[model samples]
Structures are given as C-alpha cells and as structure tokens.
Target: MTLQTLANAALILILVGWIGIRQLTWRPILVGRMWRLPIVFAAIGLFALSGSHGASSVTAVDAALLSLELVVSLGVGAAMGALATIRPLSSGDGAPDAPRFESRTGWVGLALWFVFIGVRVGIDVWAGALGSHLAASTGVIFVMVAANRVARTAVIGLRVSRLATVAPVPAGAR
Candidate 1:
C-alpha cells in the first residue's frame, strides 16, 4: 500500500472511532449538523479521485463494485438510523424551533456499523481480487462513507419530522 493509502486508512479509522463513541451516547439530533461531516468527506473523496496519486483509471468492474457498495452503504445506514432511539429534549434545553429529540444509536446501531464495515471490507477484497484498483482506493472508501452517513441522516430526519408532526405544540410557542 502507498503512504497515501495508509494515511487514508488511518484517518478513516480515527473518524469512525470518534463518531462511534458519540453514537452510543445520547445526543441531540441536529440534522443540519449531521450533514457537515458527510459533505466534508465527499469533498475529500472527490479530491482524491481527481488527484494523480489516486486511482489512475476506472474499469467496468470497478464501476459495478462501487454501485454495489453504495447500495449496501445506504441500506446499512438506513437500518442504523431506523434503529436509533429518539427521546424528547428536556424543557428549556432547546430553542423553540430547534429539534426536540435526542437520539442515540446504542448497541444495535454499533452492531449495524460493524455489519456495514464488514460488507465494505468484503467488497474491497472482492474488487482487489478482480484487479479493480479503484475499489481499493481511499477515494472510493471516502465516497462510500459519505453516502452511508447521508443515508443515515436522511432516515433520522424523516423520523424526527414525523415526530414533530404528531407532537403537540408548546402552548407558548403557539
């Protein structure tokens, strides 16, 4: 593996580790804030893919594998989001228009994260065996991670919105 590849792998592990810790704790579900990380990751992925040091070429097999990975990422991310536990935020803790729920992924979400990582690793191995370098590159991994996070955020946002619709409005706010 190249130095860049090693650096990327390390970076990914650090990111996942940091986020995993937060996922197990109760935190306010701020859909807007959730977007920043994915967007940054996507930008980095785009940069890597376009850089000379990254994947030089994309084969048909690479494309197919990437598509497959994307699908799996989305599926797993959605499952994680769906499994998240959301509780109403305490009074006076949020602004009138702020999100009312605090969400935690807990054990189940962590398990899903493992499943996602396992599937990603499996696909990467399969691609390497097929000589699809793109699949094994950092760029592809970043993109896939971004896609997964986006999927999770979307599902969580949907759930939060549903809750908002059904929840009674505070008397003062009305």
Candidate 2:
C-alpha cells in the first residue's frame, strides 16, 4: 500500500485498538495517576510522527500553508478544550459529574471536528483539483481531522464510563 494508505490504516488501527481496550478492560486504565505521563508522551509522539510525515510530503508552499492550518486548527481546538473544561468548573452545582462532562464535551468536540473537516473538504473542492498545493494541504488537513475526531471520541467515551461508575444516584430514584 502507498504511504497515504498506510497512514490511514495506522490511524484506523489505533482507533480500533483504543476502543477495544476500553471495552475489554474491566478496570479503569486512565484513572490511575501513573498513566497520565505515559498518555501525554504517547500523544506527543504521535503528533511528532504525523508532523514529520506531513512536512516531508509537502512542497515548501504547501508546507507553509499546512503549518498555518496546523496553528489555526490547534488554536481552535485549544479554545474549545478550554471552553469545555471551563464550563464544568464554572457550574456551582458541586463538582461536575464526569459522565455529564464527557457527554457534553464529546458532542462539542465531535461538532467542531466535523465543522473543520467539512471546511477543509469544501476548500479543497472549491480550489479545484488543478494540481494546486492548497488542494494537497486540504487533503492532509482532512486526514488529520479524521484521526483527531476518532481519538477524541474514544477518550470521551472512556471518560463518560468512568464518570458513570462513580456517579451517585438520587435517593428516591431507582
């Protein structure tokens, strides 16, 4: 398979593995403090690898565009993440339940992911397939968005499950 195909396959495998692990493991994996460092490192490593691949594949013009896209995407994602994090913090209804946060953040993340993906695709189509660097950059953006959305959804579900486990039910409610 080509590099693009290989990249796509690897992304799919990572997604599936994450889901499978979450489903099969009875105990909470990320709940432990030790897992935090490793998870962060793994994320960094993945980003590095993907960034290297994207840099190596694109031309200089495309690279610049891609870099700008990366910055904008990351800024938007960070803003959203912060917004999601802050919403729960601001609510005076005691500590926010993890499941509720997970569900709310998950939907928001998914919506943002879809919007970004759609925008990238729309831009590419509008630019036409006339062998332009913008088209190629948009393609890369699309792939990155797909990978991110999958990872985000998996994490969201895991958080939701953990929150559910610890959540208290109403006294009279069954």
Candidate 3:
C-alpha cells in the first residue's frame, strides 16, 4: 500500500471511531449543527475527486460502483437515523422555554454502522478486483460518508421537527 493509502485508511478508522462513539451517546438534536459535518465532507470529497481523477479519466465501471456505494450509504444512514431514540428533555434538564430533544443510536445503531462499513469495504475490494481503482479512491470514501451523514441528518431533522411541534414549551418559560 502507498503512503497515501495508509494515511487514508488511518483517517477512515479514526473517523469511524469518533463518529461511532458520538452517535452512541445522548446528544441534543440540533439540525443546523448536524448539517455542518456532511456539507464540509462533501465539499472536501468533491475537491479531492476533481483534483485526483479529472472527468476525462472516469470510467463507466467507476461511475457505476460509485453510484452503488452512494446508494448503499444513504440507505444505511437513513436506517440508522430511523433507529435513533429521540426523547424530549425535561424542564429540570435545562432550558424549559427552548425545548429540545436528545437522541441516541444505541447498539442497534452501532450495528448498522458496521453494516455500512462492511458494505463500503466490500465495494472497495470489488472495485480493486475489477481494476476500477478510481471507484475505490479515498475521495470516494468521503463522498459516500457525506451522503450517509446527509441522509441520517435529514431523517433526524424531520423527526425532531415533528416532535417539537407535538412538544410544547412550558408556559412563561420563554
């Protein structure tokens, strides 16, 4: 493996560890904040792709595999978001007027994460076997991850908005 490949692998491992831990915790569902990571990741991925593999060099196989990876990522992410447990924080918890929901993915969510990783790795291996290296580029990984996060964020945002409408803030707590 090249140094770049090793670095990319290390980065992926660190991201998986950090992101997985965060998802398993109970954290406030803030849609605005949730959008940041995915957006940034997508931009970085796009930049990397454009720089590393220009349009002229893209093969049909690479395109097809990338599409499949993206679809899988989005699907798995939506599943993870759907499985998340969202609950309203009590007034005693804090900010009674500014009602908020806390979310946790728990073990099942973690398992889905593994499924996502497994499918991603599998796709990469398949791409390598097919000699479509561009399909398994590090840039593609970021793009796929961004797609996954975007799907999860959308689902969670919808859930949070629905919950907010149903959950009223305490009177005079504003």
Candidate 4:
C-alpha cells in the first residue's frame, strides 16, 4: 500500500479504537474498564506490526530508539495520569459519596488518551515520511502503547491506593 494509504488506514483504525474506548468507559466503572485501553492499544499495535512486512527483522538502532522512546513516553504518561487522577477527599454535599473532583478525572483520562494517540500517529507519520533509518520501525507503536498503558495503569493504581488512606484532619481541627 502507498504511504498515504497506510497512514489513512492507521487513522481509521485509531478512530475506531477511540470510539470503542469512549463507549466502553461511558458507563459506571466496571471490572473490565481498567484493562480496556491497554488491551485495545496493544492489539492495534500488533495489527500494525503484522502488516508492516518484515517487522521481525530489526537493527540495533531501531531497538535502541524504541527502548528510549518507551521509557520517555512512559514517564510522560505517568506525569499526565497523575494530573488526571487528582480527587478531593470528599464531596460538596457533605455526603461521603457525592464527588465533584472525581467526575472530571474520567474526562482527564479521556483527554490523556487522545494525547497518546496523537503522539502515536505523529511519530508513525514522521518515521514513515522521513524513512529515517534511525526512526523506529513499526514496532514503536507497540512499545508506545505499552508504555502509555503501563504508566497510566500504575498512576491510576496509585491514585486508588491514595484513596484508601485515611484522610488527614484539617489544620483547624488540629
């Protein structure tokens, strides 16, 4: 397929994946929600790799670049996920359940999700359009998605853990 054809195909698949993510997360949290993004992105990466022809063949440079990008992207995802997961200890209604800060977190996660997608598509296009030998081959997609998911999951897990901690008394109470 032509380069543009491949890019367009990749965009279409990404849009489909994005839509799936939105639909999957629109409802209340479920046991399955946590794993959906990582799995979907990983599956997409695998699909991209399979179609890349000769993806199994890689040079040292490509390996190194992928590794570096993975680490950097993972760090980026973690930082952003931290911002996305911020929540207040309680709600405005004086009820333990009603929450304002918590609601925006889902939107934050969704925004970060699209940010990761943008990075993936931008890098893919750059690598393809330039044909730079230094650029990561198709395998970068898998690593990028893996990095994003791992960091995001870790951050979210940390957020949940923090939620379990006992709330500190306000200064006036002390």
Best by lDDT: 3
Better of 2 and 3 by TM-score: 3
Error (Å) of candidate 1 at residue 31 is 1.3
Off by over 4 Å in 3: 91-99, 169-174
In model 2, where do residues sit more than 4 Å from their true spots? 1-58, 85-103, 126-130, 133-143, 146-174
- Report the C-alpha lDDT of model 4 over 113-161, residue by residue, as the tens digit: 6665666556555555555333434444555766676686677666655
Go through the candidates in order and give each one's C-alpha lDDT: 0.81, 0.43, 0.82, 0.55
Name the runs in model 1 displaced over 4 angstroms. Answer: 1-5, 52-56, 169-174
Write one digit per residue (lDDT tens) for candidate 3, span 17-108. Answer: 98889878998777888899999999998888887744448888888988898889999999988999988655444544343777999989
Q: In candidate 4, which residue ranges exceed 4 Å CA deviation?
A: 4-32, 88-122, 129-139, 168-174
In model 4, what lDDT does residue 119 have? 63
Q: How far is candidate 4 from the true structure (C-alpha RMSD, Å)?
A: 6.8
Q: Order of all candidates by lDDT, from best down to worst?
A: 3, 1, 4, 2
**TM-score of each prediction:** 0.88, 0.38, 0.89, 0.58
Question: Residue 85's C-alpha lDDT in candidate 2?
Answer: 29
- Candidate 4, residue 31: the lDDT equals 20
**Top candidate by TM-score:** 3
User: Candidate 2 residues 1-174, lDDT tens each?
Assistant: 346445644654564455334333232222233235335544654565465534455555565545655555555444433333211111223433321232233445445645554555444444334434443432354444444434443454455455556764333332
- State which candidate, 1 or 3, has the greater TM-score: 3
Q: Report the poorest 10 consecutive residues by lDDT, candidate 4.
A: 23-32
The CA lDDT at 4 in model 2 is 47
